[model samples]
Target chain A: MAENRLDIRYVAHLARLALTPDEETKLSAQLGNILGYIEKLKQPDVAGVEPTAHAVPLINVTRPDAVGVSLSQEEALRNAPASASGLFIVPKIVE
Target chain B: MLHRLTISDLAAKLARREVSAREIMQSCLDQIARVDGRIHAFISHDAEDALAQADAADRELTRGVAGKPLLGIPIALKDVLAVKNQPLHCGSKILDGFISPYDATVVEKLRAAGAIVFGRLNMDEFAMGSSTENSAFGPTRNPWDIERIPGGSSGGSAAAVAADECIASLGSDTGGSIRQPAALCGVVGLKPTYGRVSRYGLVAFASSLDQIGPLAKTVSDAATLLGAMSGHDPRDSTSVPQPVPDYGAALTGIKGIKIGLPAEYMIGGLDPEAKAAVDTAVKKLAGLGAEIVDISLPHTDYAVATYYIIATAEASANLARFDGVRYGARVEGADLAEMYCGTRGAGFGPEVKRRIILGTYVLSSGYYDAYYLRAQKVRTLIRNDFLQAFETVDAIVTPTAPTAAFRIGEKSADPLQMYLSDIFTISCNLAGICGISIPCGFTSAPRLPIGLQLLGKPFGEESILKIAAAFEQDTAWHGQKPPL
Candidate 1:
């Protein structure tokens, strides 16, 4: 668990949040508490338990071979905050 | 006339032409206008479009065309589902102005079946909380008791069905969002087998666990809705290619059927009143000629921990799409990074942000093996426990939730306590099994509705609905309506 305020800021940055000063203080405490609780799980012993990710026995499930049309460009861009010619408009990336 | 009728009853009326689809749609619109203010069940409604569809259905029926099973039935969808031309806000201020230009696969199926898609209903912001209090719009009050919560993420669908704003509604379940609210609101909720229904346009919360299902007043109504809503959708990769069964045919009789009682679920933390209600339900099932057996699901206690790690990890990745870009509300800033931060920070509710951070931490490089991997192992153990239990019994029965609906704002401050509310329902999703929650009885304390859950194996909805229908027939629990 992170202890210093700076370390907390680092983790918050990783999460993409720009925390306010008060939020930094409050979240540091809350995250520390949560980490402390999570530490309890480390105590459980399992000498050779293989890590399991999926619950059911499943392989890649595929649909039938059929052609289907996807949403049109106009439909896809209907909800965009800003759009150019058949594309979503975002802040310019290049200098 | 349509307000008090069940889906099956309304379908019968439509088939006989005793009432036109337009008439039923009008009744639903009138009911929504009357009760939606106090209930807050709907987020968006298109009366003109719905009436137009109803008119089309009526025209088809007049030409001696039967249309489809759900023809002319008015249904409300959770806002999480995409409906073309409607603002699918998903109960968040961030997506407040976002409108879907295409329908979700299920929405398209419903429309094709001639069902009048009435409107989008309210829900927990991004389906993150057990109570609709997490909704950015506002918390949906329980119709039964205005002071208590209508157990959520699917609270809007549950309350809408309970208040008769719609005969049936579609809600997605990721750890009992559908069943918990349905149980509290005195309705029938189903969570189909993981691959049984499509997740194409569900607005992914926990991709593996999320499934859209139905909530209705009767078991048969839920079955009818499920049959029409399910099938192989090429658009949804996880959808099964198997033929959709006639769910109505399965509800006939449960004579000499086997029902398992998972003893672990009946132990400590279960309200005594809830236990008594379940006990009475067991007796009723036995009287209907079904054999009840005490069974074991050993790893039930670890369900919540395992569920959080997996669900949160997926949520963290799934929610990454919401940075101030393509659609929805965006908070702008001078730099790209700041824009992303500002938008997410303002758009998401507190619980959603908390889960995302927790998920990110678990999946982080240093903690991956310890938190995320270990939880996955435990999740396997949980699934195995259910598989082992199924070998000895056809279906497992337990209380849907530990207690009935709590007062709104009661557990909002304590996130851990709120997570535990999903303890009983989470395991079903983990195991990739199907389950249903129906009103069994009422708690004596505040007289809130208590739900009885039945878990079945993969594609075992037919068996589960049979048992639920039997229970419904033997008792008047489903008939009792909340006085709004």
Candidate 2:
């Protein structure tokens, strides 16, 4: 594993995920193997190469912010696991 | 027999008034009832809804609304695509209770073309895995041999087509998901050029890499579906504004085309028999007057590694919208943060979680340049490699997968091994080129099907589709059905 390879717990935390202890151990080894193999990218000196964000490039794709027929509140909220009064509900913060 | 008919054939029958649309729907429904119990290709489908649409289509035909392509044909969609008022599981526990409020652009087009749109085929959770084993709902068994895996995340789509459950099915390809399974299942699959089809309402995996395409029994049927499904949509910002050509008309003799065979794709883990089949396919192409030349895609070895980094990085960001506060299944927690964690942790499958971890690590502080940025730079070189090669050859040919479909548990334990198998398929996505897999031959011992892949330049579906149609028409491989 690379010396600076990320800790599995830290990665899960950053991604807002929670893993059991066994999952953490297994994932650490798995992720370590993946990152170790990725060290091959270092062989090429891409000092001046511009990164490709899109495969077939797109440039300045924007549309006017006009209101169109959008999903109604009832339709959108129908799939919500927890909703009340036409709004999504989640656990409370700020006690 | 109706299910066995291609979309083109079925459309012709509908126009001739030889069969009612309801009869076509009943044939698909009967086939599903007969075989889907063992294959498990569909996650969900409504017979009543399908029959209802078919009855309406029959009425339209009676009223002189005929000759529309794909009319009264039944098509299955990979679970990832949204069909209005239908359950959109996406083969995961996360979106278990969710129902799509509107149709995907493709689904809307299918309805307008008078096709019965119903079945939600199983897939790798969020289209992540090479084998459907990663699905939270159980793996889809290969129709060819019940013990083997159907190559995924479009395994169900491939299997459904092979089993004659639907006239055709749509599958999204990121890294050989559509083609590999299509090859393994003895079916025809086409991954259209990136942006050839709009991605509107398709669940995002790696948005930049994802392309929706077709899997069917014949190349003409795939072409028929692609022509109807593809076009620019304001709903998808990345959709190219180019007009979709009549792909069926592109089918012609391949007398003078130049085809490049990358020497690398034949080596390494490729089974000898599978390799021989592709070699035979190359000979066939050459005999048809296509100039077959040896070409080197020097960066072939690095595609898997590069794909893992770029695809996962994008996935980690794309999946962030699935937190518990909004729609989708959620688990209760004391605080807002806990709710988000609990929901995702329980809802996602192991492979999905692993990718999320891998993705988050690469994009985080201290390692972003080492992994994410470096991978993107390497991605450019891979694309450039293909672009340079296309100048010499009109298309490139290779084996769709390293070997025939392995047993279900074969590579599931090792993430690296699973990721490595995507080698031949991933580069096409990285380069944003079109590719297709047609049944070339089968392995002798296992009797498993092998796929021959022909990749095209950007927006060059016409060239590859023409070549595939020619090869398919001459060979009996695509006509052979699995013993169900």
Cα lDDT tens digits, model 2, B1-484, are 8888888888888888999999999999999999999999998898999999999989998998854687788888999999999988888999978889999999998888778888899999999998899888899999999899999999999999999999899999998999988998989999988888989889999988999999999998888888989888888889989988999999999999999999888886898999999999999999888999899998878888889999999999999988877788888998877888998998898999999988888888887887888888888888988999999999999999988989999999999988887878999998999999999999998799999999999999999999999898889999888899
Model 1 lDDT tens row, B30-146: 988988898998877998988998999889889877648888889999999988788888888878688887788888888887788868888998899999999988999898988
For model 2 the local lDDT of residue B244 reads: 86
Candidate 2's error at A95, in angstroms? 3.5
**First chain TM-score in every candidate?**
0.78, 0.89
User: Which runs in model 1 stand beyond 4 Å of their true positions?
Assistant: A1-8, A22-52, A55-58, A62-67
Q: Return the DockQ of model 1.
A: 0.44
Model 2's CAPRI class is medium
Error of 2 at B452 (Å): 0.5
Candidate 1: the clashing residue pairs are none
Complex DockQ per candidate: 0.44, 0.71
Candidate 2 stretches with Cα past 4 Å from truth are A1-4
